[model samples]
Target: GGLPYVLTAHEGSAAFAADVMGRLTGAPGLCIATLGPGATNLTTGVGNAYLDRSPLLALTCNLPTAQLGRRIQMAIDHHALFRPLTKATLALREGAVASVLAEALQVALSEPLGPVHLDLPEDVALAPATEAVPAPPSGRRLAAAPEPARRRAAELLGAARRPVAVLGSSAMRLRNPGLLQAVIERHRLPFATTTMAKGMISEEHPLSLGCIERARRQVQRELLGGADLVVGLGYDVVEVEYEAWLGKVPLLSIDVDPVDADASVTIAHEVVGDLDASLGWLAQLPPARPEWGADLAARHRERFQRALRPPRAGFVPHHAIDVVRAALPRDGILAFDVGAHTHQIASQWTAHAPRTFLITNGWSSMGFGLPAAIAAKLACPERPVVAIVGDGCFQMTVGEVAVARRLGLSLPIVVLDDGWLSLIQVKQVRRRFGLYGTDLGEQALVDPPAHYFGVPAIGAGSAAELARALTDALVADHPTVIEARVDPGHYLDTVYD
Candidate 1:
């Protein structure tokens, strides 16, 4: 196998590493660990993959069969521990390795993809087996939309005075942008995406309404309520809760699997088949009312423009986002860590293509930015990759930078230093409880001592300096860490009313 193996400092962070690898490569990612603490450490990443719907295979080394269930050191029920977090959990048997691995891989790559766990006891690993390796699993065959279902979906869309498309994470799997674009253009439909599907369609497109998580509630209400039919293109309940559209609109789900909406959300029609095929069918139907969502699109554009403008002073996250957006090439990929900065960046960052802006909104896990950047760089070595992370998140997995340096990766990591868990601090202020245990003191990650991890470090306290630093980092031959001092109160101005 030509697969490269890179070790991380912590097992918990391995989740982000595998998540980014799966997300970028569209293959089942592998994460390895030993029993006890290593196995427990993998739980965070495993659970994150489970919720985020990334295909991951968690391999752990367990105790021997004889030692199982005994009060031995580093012994625990690995199967029971991972059962809830994985699609399937198995203890590897000496003679069944081939079939077990094949089955586990299949489950991991299936629709609504998730993590699978395999516990390999030391004795089982050393046991002699005569069984031959099984053949690789066959390629997955996508289900096509049935004629009757297609007709019903077409009829519903045709009858509606106003139709809108709500794209979700599952749409990313379609990989048929042209067909989806045709459907949207043919119907003159205004489209919105979940946070995870930020770049499903280019936000720069005229009909795009950006991300739902970034939109104001009133805007979401008006757009969704005004629609006579809401066409869900590969929507997943895990990405965006059904409560958002419940009783607000009539949904027509079009996905590989049937709609997973709960009782509150009523799906009028469902086309349970391939996304591209369904969209191709819809594209062949008569276009909806030409001016159905024109007004809403205009308002969305207005808000999008307003959101991109630089603040009067200070290092505003949106301003930083705009600077980075301009600095990187159109196809460059950006990974964001979970924090107050994510919401603003999700709204303001204009992704020109799919898979450009990566974030962990599904798991909302911190310290994902750096690992995601590493995967992005590996996936597209020719394209630029940057990680925009918060101070708290950077501290969580900052040591990974050493790995990046050793691998000779020229990754630009921008650390937003606010001296606090800014997202939680904002929530605390809103609740009038005051910030406690959130502060990390007034620490700035400026100039590193010479040869610090063999990486250059830069510090910026203003928008201009930050932009300049990013420009330099982008062209640098080695890894660069940019510590940007930003206002902690900026979240209040951008996120809240």
Candidate 2:
């Protein structure tokens, strides 16, 4: 296979890297692992692909055919271990390598793309065989739903007093966003994006309601509360259920597949087929002059902007994010780790392009930032890539710094240092519980190693210092870790829903 690969620090790291590669490249990303412990570590990222609908192929080594059932070292029921975590669990039989591989790829990249596990027994690891013809990838350019269904969908939009649209994770697969944006503009619809779908359209676009899961989520949710029609364009219910947001509102779905609307969400009409074709159909429908005053999305967008303004002057998360945003170019890739910082960036960061902002809203794993950034850099070397991790997240994946250094990857690892699991701490406090296990002991990166396994480690105490550090890392030969010592006070002040 001509596919690119990296020797990651851990099996989990490799899988996460594959996950990002799949999302960014719109093809199956492949990761190889050894038996037992290696197979076990891959579950987190593999599960992320399962729920997130990313195309991934997880190849693992196992005991030889005769010894597979015995209690040999590093032997376990791998098929059982991965069955629940993958779309399909397959094995390499004597002469079926080619066919098994073809099936695995077909399943991994099918509708609602997900991870597929392929186990290669030791004896068959180096075997050569005739290659089987792989199934052709599914065509996404199908005609929009039947004319009656589309007309009904259009009729619902035409008759509704207030209709809103939501862009979901599936939108990332869009080959032409211009068509999607045309439909949004033609209808003058207000729109909100799921966390993972951030930047399908520019967050700064006048029609954007920003992301709906964090930072003033109440404001965004309330905007969706009064909708008469909710247009779910390529929206996948895994990131958010229709019941939580849309409630009993009538839904019109336009995507490559039928929308997974919850029971409470009435299917007013569904235009299921090619998204661009549906969007083209919507664009051609005589523009409907609805009852919404002005564009509700653009109007609410102002309120969202007001709420996200720099709330305090200290070296806080919001301010730190502002600095990073300013230093990063419009095309730079930001891979965010899961934590309190995720809540802030998901809403506050201004994303102009799809796949430029990578976060795991489906599985939402910690320690995802480093590997994701590394893989993103590998995929698109011309674009600058940075990993924004929390203090806790940095500790969990710190060993990957060695991987970054070894590869001479020009990636920057930015750690927001508050020394605790801030997101979980908020929940504990809400329950009137003490800090307990959330604390990470030390708050400062005192006497931080000058070089982490040959990669430089630097400290930034203020916004100005952080900007300088990021600027330098962009041109560095290897990975640079910048510990931005920031206060966590702003997290409690701003993040919500």
Candidate 3:
């Protein structure tokens, strides 16, 4: 494989990087860790992969077989630790290393791909006479939806007065993702996207209804409620469950994974199989004259845009995000950490293609943004990549900035310094609770450092300064940290409620 083994500052960071690799490359990403603490640190990222459906191969060392299960120093049960967090957990025996790894790869890469753990005993790592691992598995054509279900789904769509296709992240994993656009546009149906699915089709497309799950959510929900039919294109409930949006409306789910049978949502038809091929089947559907047309989508898109604007702002985090979005290209990759800022980025940022807009939603974790951006840069070095993280989240993986500097990556890590765990503080304010520990010692009032480790650091106190910094950082020869001072108080009005 031509994959690069980039060392991250922490095992947790490495795990995030591995998940990003798997999401981008569609192969099982590999991550190795020492025993005990290292493997434990990997759990959060691996769990993120498991729930978010990214393929990963997590490898960890354990005590030698002779002393296995004994109370050994620095040795904890690797399998038990990873068992709940991964798709499968295995211990690689001496002679079966290749076979075990081959199996692990398959399990990790299986449909609804997820993380798998493999343990290599101390003795096994030093063994000889081992055969080389074989070439990786090639892609296979997943089965298309059964004729009956596809026809049934098509019939439902044909009869509906209001039909909406919701593109989810899983759809991007399919072959010929263009088929998703083809099917929806062929029928002149209006569509909205889940956060992860935003850029599968250009958001600029006239039929686009913007994203659900963030910013002016009521409008998106209203649009969804008006639909007599809801078609899930490669949608996964883990992103946003059906009961939350679908209501009692008839659903036509077409994806690689089957719809959950126990879900409370009504299934007019559930078509499971190759989502790409199913789109071809859907192309044959008798087109419906949608009562809800471009007018509705335009209205919703505008409202989304209006709500997306940072409100009553004297340099809020939302304004900083707007500057970054304006400066970044339509095709640029943005990896963001979880916090109050994520609420704004999920809907405001323009994602031109899948995987171009990367964020952890299902297992939304802090410290993910920097590592994910690092992995994206490694995967597509020619592309412009940036990470926008909040002050609190950035502190979790600040050391990883040094790793980017060492790689000499021309990356920009934009940190929004808001002083508090603004997302949480907002919640406390609603209950009239005192904002005691939420403050990070008045970060915005403090002077910004000139560098993080060896990486060049700059300060941006205004929109113009932030834009200039981004323009400079994007083309720089090394990683740059642009810390922008801002008040995240606007989130108290927007996503806080």
Top model number, lDDT: 3
A best-first ranking of the candidates according to their TM-score comes to 3, 2, 1
lDDT value, candidate 3, whole model: 0.85
lDDT of 1 by residue, 1-497 (tens): 76688888788777678977887887888999999999999888888888888888999998887888898899989999999999999879888888899988888887668899999999999988777877756335477888999989888888887777888887776657677778888988898888888777788788888777552434565557777778888877776676655466888888877777667777899998877788888888887774463477768767665854535566667767777888888899999899888877877777888889888767788878888888788778889999999989988888888878877887899888878888888778878996798998865544434534777778777778888988888887778988877776667655643
Model 1, C-alpha of 115: deviation from truth (Å): 1.3
In model 1, the runs with Cα more than 4 Å from the true position are 127-131, 139-142, 215-218, 245-247, 257-266, 293-299, 307-312, 443-452
- In model 2, how large is the Cα lDDT of residue 136? 52
* Pairs clashing within candidate 2: none
The Cα error of candidate 3 at residue 43, in Å, is 1.3
For residues 1-497, what per-residue lDDT tens digits would candidate 2 score against the true structure? 86555788888999999999998887888888999999999888899888888899999999888898899898999999999999999989878887878788878876667899999998897666656666655523456578888888878888887888899888877667777688888988878898888888888887788888687778877878788888998888778777776767788888777766546678888788776667778888877666777666667877886786656777888888888898888899999899989988988898988889999988889988999999899889999998899999988899999999888899989999988899988777767888789988876445457888888899888899899999999999889999988888767756654
Q: Which has the greatest TM-score?
A: 3
Ten-residue segment with the worst summed lDDT in candidate 2? 135-144
Deviating ranges (above 4 Å) for candidate 2: 1-3, 129-144, 256-263, 295-299, 444-447
lDDT, candidate 3, 1-497, per-residue tens: 66567788899999999999998888877888999898898888899899888999999988889988888788888888999899899989988988888888888877768899999888999889568877776444567777888777877888888888898878867768788888878898888889888789988888888888775567678778888888888888788788876788788888888787456788888888977788887776667778875577777888877876745757877789889989888889999999888877887777788779998878888989999999999888999999999989898999999999999999999999988888788778988998877889865365577788989889888899999999999999999999899877778666743
Model 1 vs. true fold: TM: 0.93
Order of candidates by lDDT, top first?
Answer: 3, 2, 1
